[model samples]
Target chain A: MLYVELIAQGLIQGSIYALIALGLTLVYGLLRILHVAHAAFFTLGGYVGVVVANQTGSLAAAIVAAMIVAGLGGIVVFRLCYQPILHQPPFVPLIASIGLYIAAEELFRIVFGPSGLTYKYAFLQGEVELLGFLRFKTGELVVVFGSAAIIGVLSLLQTRTRIGVACQATVSDPQMAESFGISLSRVGDINFFVGSALAAFAGVMVSVLNNMVEPTMGSVPSYKALAIIVLGGLGSVRGTLVAALVLGVVESFGTIYLGHFLDRNAIAFAFLILVLMWRPQGLFARS
Target chain B: MLRLERFSCGYGLFRAVSELELEVPHGTITGLIGPNGAGKSSTLMCVAGHVNLLAGSIVFDELDIGGLPATERVRRGIAIAPEGRRLFKDLSVEDNLRVGGLIHPAGRFKADRDYVLSLFPRLGERLGSLAANLSGGEQQMLSIGRALMARPKLIMIDELSLGLMPKMVDLCYDALLRLKQDGMTILLVEQNTDRVLSVADHVCVLESGHAVWSGNAADARNDPTLAAAYLGLH
Candidate 1:
């Protein structure tokens, strides 16, 4: 029963990780940029979600507001920051992303206060009994089921729609896509919007689950997502998902079993190093 | 019809084509034939808005399109099947075509796809397969077919026969001829001088980024000095 509870906790955490990592994977897949600043969007979403929920006292409104803010912010960042340096070396934009992320963290501290913000209203606060004996938080259920639904919709959009096909073409061959009239800029805009929105959603969920939102809240997940993407294989969405879930489970188990020797994050990184050493191409990467 | 007047295009600090004047009439095939480094591909890329046009104007159907982006150029009815057949390798053949027709309404997709399938029936059989899985010839065919999905009034083909089997080349050329008969303007850059001469209504022979000779196909074929000197034909 304890193992089952731990497994459930791991999966819930993994679902949130998957949400954050998907954004990183999408941006990396489209532009080959590491997008470290994605964490800023996540932080911004948490702030937006908290402020809106506090003011209106509605969770749905908070989520919607957070998504809009983060999605549009992503487009602005892509246009003003990443687009200009895209023609340069890959590291140029990556460094810019890191710089932007640091700047955003500092800005958030200045604006939102260095201390942190807490949810004013109690939402998804109760625990539900599941499968006759097990217990689960309503927030955990929402995180798992919500993340799965969003990922499902995203996959469907990529596979079933015209814009999705155009995006895929642009990803595979930008110049060729341009020759066929698919604008690379448009594709970049859409990718950044979608990816950033997902990150923001994760931020809101995390804030709700933890009942806290702070400037430094995005820092851990940012690096964790980076590790997950690299471990899953950069630019591979499905790999990122699997890696996120696996890392979540490992961390959940390791926090109890291996806490005496190493920290949870250390365990995740160690796992990444092992996996990379074994299959440098990544678990799901096509050789 | 498409007209390039004093067109100069190149990569940054490196001129690939300079002050090249050329014209492709409607319902005709114009062949630009040259040896390696003769700016054949560069000329086509410039017209397609892929390469930078340093000077002069690209007039397509009386619209000055020199400053337009590649996507706008496609909307104005110009498309290209570029060198190396740069298809979306992860996408299915049908998806590649769908992306090509992105500017059009979704309602028009079926007709455009059907038209492309008619041109390259082999694509119909492998629409479900990924682009990377196709053979070289099929890839080339799909590349051309993808461009056709845009329903362009003018199509520019770079290295139409390069890396293609003779049988595949013949099939591609046959499709080009059919496109011409259907009143589509074609600007083709080819290394196969003989094939170009046989099919091209007009021919321009480029050498070192300059037009060495420009004339009708009959005139080019009849001029033994021009043929032997530039066309490498005795």
Candidate 2:
């Protein structure tokens, strides 16, 4: 019964991780930028959601408002800090992103103060029993189901839409895509907006699950996302999905079984190291 | 229909072509022939807006397109089948073609796609397969077909017959002729001088980024200096 409960918890937790990996993979696939500020956007989303939900007392509006604000923030970051130096070395944009991440984290500190916060909601606090041994919170169910639906939709969008195909083409070969009349810069901007939006949503989802929000909440999850991206393969959406779920389950078990020595958060890195040592290219990375 | 007057282009601090004056009149095949590193690809890429244009102008339909980006140039009716046939390896043949025509009206998608299928019937057969799954010859055909889907007035094909069987090359040249008859302008860069001379209306031979010779294909074929030195026509 405890095992099943842990597994359920891991599945819910993994959904949020998958969301972060999905954003990382999406932006990395197109722009090849590390985009550390994406994690900052995650923190931004939590703050935005917190304020909106508290003021209006609506979770739906909070998530919507968070997505919009973080999405626009993504576009602004892309235009200002990222796009101009795209022609530079890959490390150049990566370093700029790191700088942006630090600056944004500090801004959050100034605005929200140097402490943690959580949302207060009655509907989100209740729990429901599933099967004989599994009982999950309403918030946990939302995390699992919502992440699955969003990921499913994103997968469909990537394979079915014109912009999605264009993004894939650009990823494969930028020069050829350009010759074929695809604007490389334009595609990068759209991807940044999308990837950042996903991060924003994931941020709120994670907050909803824990009933806690903090400026530094994205810090640990962001590292876990990097690990998840590597585990699934650098730029593969399907890989990220599977890797995130497996990781979430593993972390949950590790917390229960190896809880004394290894914290639940630290398990992500431990698994990442194991996966990397075993498969250098990741589980789903193509040659 | 396309003109490059004193056009100079290259990577930073390295000029690939200098003071190059060239023109492809509307509805003509201008075969640009040269050895490796002779700037044939650079010139074609320059016209397609890939290589940086450090000097001069690229005038098309009385509009200067030198400063425009690659997609903007494509929007203005210019396309290129770049070197190495850089197809979207993960995408199906149909999806690759669709992406090529994204800038054009969605209504013409079927018409333009049908036109390309007519040109390369093999592509029609393999429309559902990933580009990476295709043979080298088939990939080349698909690359050209993708460029055609844009409905561009001028199409520049780099190394049109590179790394393909002779029969496949003949088929590609046949498509080129058919395209020419349809009133399309072509700037074809090739190493196969004899094959280029066989059908090209005009020819430009580059040596060390300079236009060493430019004239009607017949004159180029008869010129003993060019025949033995560059074209190997003898």
Q: Write model 1 residue lDDT over B1-234, tens digit each, in one string.
A: 899899889999999988899999998999999898999999988888889999999999998999999888999999899988898999999898898888889999999899888888988999999999999999999988888889999998888889889999998999998898888999999988999999999999999998999989989999999988899886
Sliding window of 10 residues with minimal summed lDDT for model 2 chain B: B99-108
Listed per prediction, chain B TM-scores read 0.98, 0.98
i-RMSD of all predictions: 0.9, 1.0
TM-score, each model? 0.96, 0.97
lDDT for A175 in candidate 2 is 82
lDDT of 2 by residue, A1-287 (tens): 88888888888888888877787887887777777778998998899988889888999999899988888888888889988998899999999988888888889889998887778775376878889668788888887888788778876887788888888889988888887778877787777777777888888877877777887888887888888888899888889889999999999999888999988877778888888999999999965
Q: For all candidates, what are the clash counts? A: 0, 0
| Deviation of model 2 at A244, angstroms | 1.3
- Tell me which residue pairs clash in candidate 2: none
Q: Which stretches of candidate 2 lie over 4 Å from their true place?
A: A1-3
User: In model 2, what lDDT does residue B37 have?
Assistant: 97
> lDDT (CA) for every model shown?
0.91, 0.87
